[model samples]
Target: MGRTSDAGEKILAAGRSLFEARGYSALGVAEICKAAGVPKGSFYYFYASKEALALAVVDEHWADQRREWTRILSGVGKDGGDAGGAQPLDRLRKLFEETEAGQHAVQQGCGTVLGCLFGNLSLEMSNQTEAVRARLQEIFDAQVEMVAAVIGEARERGDVTVNDSREAARSVVAQLEGQVMFAKLYNNTGRLSPLWGNCLALLGARAA
Candidate 1:
């Protein structure tokens, strides 16, 4: 049973990498099975179809992202906190800095999974795959809500000029997605550097 589970995980990991490197239309079940070293028969045993596997991949990816965001946010004022003595906005900056470092570490700016999956599917599957699109939308909505919470805190403390947390949150979330899209188009993460300050300014924080 453990070996079977491991095999399934291997297939999911391979699928994720392929989907990240090359958008959905470019990756097929056969290629994923080949990369995972799993037989076609075994692939069917795990996932009913390529679309099913894609859904699983999306679920896993968003789950992992939520956990990562939780960890970063939770660490702000807890024991062994990151960047002691930093304000909430500074901590948020650290979060982006860490993300940028990870992107550079992988030698691919902006970590293409979120951008590739959402961008490709939004364009290609809008009419065909409503379920997939809805799932992706839910993940994005959750992220936007998280951003709103952060901005709401800033507003409470008079750190930002935004009158509506919800609107500010949406704007910041849109900017983030736009930045990722621009990074993907340009094949460079540096396009996001200037926008970081712009985000701070939007939050009424002085540029650091």
Candidate 2:
């Protein structure tokens, strides 16, 4: 029982890594199982098809990322305590900073920026799979709402002047994805440096 569950997890981790590094269309189930160090039968045992595995990978990644995003954007500590009293805009800035740092770390590990898995798959596979397309839409919608909540708070506190918080938040999320795409294209994490400034502008913050 223990080994059975472990095999599924290994396949998931391998799929996520390969999908992020190579995009989805370029990979095959045999290749994924090889990377997972499991037999091809093990793949069939856990996933009905590659698309099903893709959905699993996306869900697992989002579950982890949503936790991190909540902790940072909501200013809640991992211990369920206050997270240093960061203001809304400041928490937003930290999100960008952490993004840059994360890409940099991935570059150092793999010698190239892998961009974002969700964004990469959205471009590469959204047209090919309706399931993946709908899932990606749902993910981005949640992200926009999270950022909009922050923007709404900032507006109430006079920290920003945005009229439509949701629209501004969509712009901010779009900007983040665009900048991450540029970072991957240029093979330079530095391309992400302007995200905070661009976000401030989107929010109509006085500092911007």
lDDT of each: 0.70, 0.91
Judging by lDDT against the true structure, name the best candidate.
2
Error of 2 at 134 (Å): 0.4
lDDT of 1 at 189: 68
TM-score of each: 0.84, 0.94
Q: What does candidate 1's lDDT look like per residue over 99-187, in tens digits?
A: 55545555454344234356556666667777888888888788777777777777777777878877877776677667767766776
For candidate 2, the lDDT comes to: 0.91
Which candidate achieves the best TM-score against the true structure?
2
TM-score computed on alpha carbons, candidate 2: 0.94
**Decoy 1 TM-score against native:** 0.84
Query: Given candidate 2, what's the lDDT at residue 146?
Result: 90
After superposition, the stretches of candidate 2 with alpha carbons farther than 4 Å from their true spots are 1-5, 77-82
Q: Counting only residues 3 or more apart in sequence or on different chains, how many pairs clash (N, Cα, C under 3 Å) in candidate 1? A: 0
Candidate 2: tens digits of C-alpha lDDT, residues 1-208: 3553588999998999999899998999999999999999889999999999999999999998888888889887657788674799988887888789989999999999999999999999888999999999999999999999989899999999989999999899999999999999999999999999899988889888
- Estimate candidate 1's alpha-carbon lDDT, on a 0 to 1 scale: 0.70
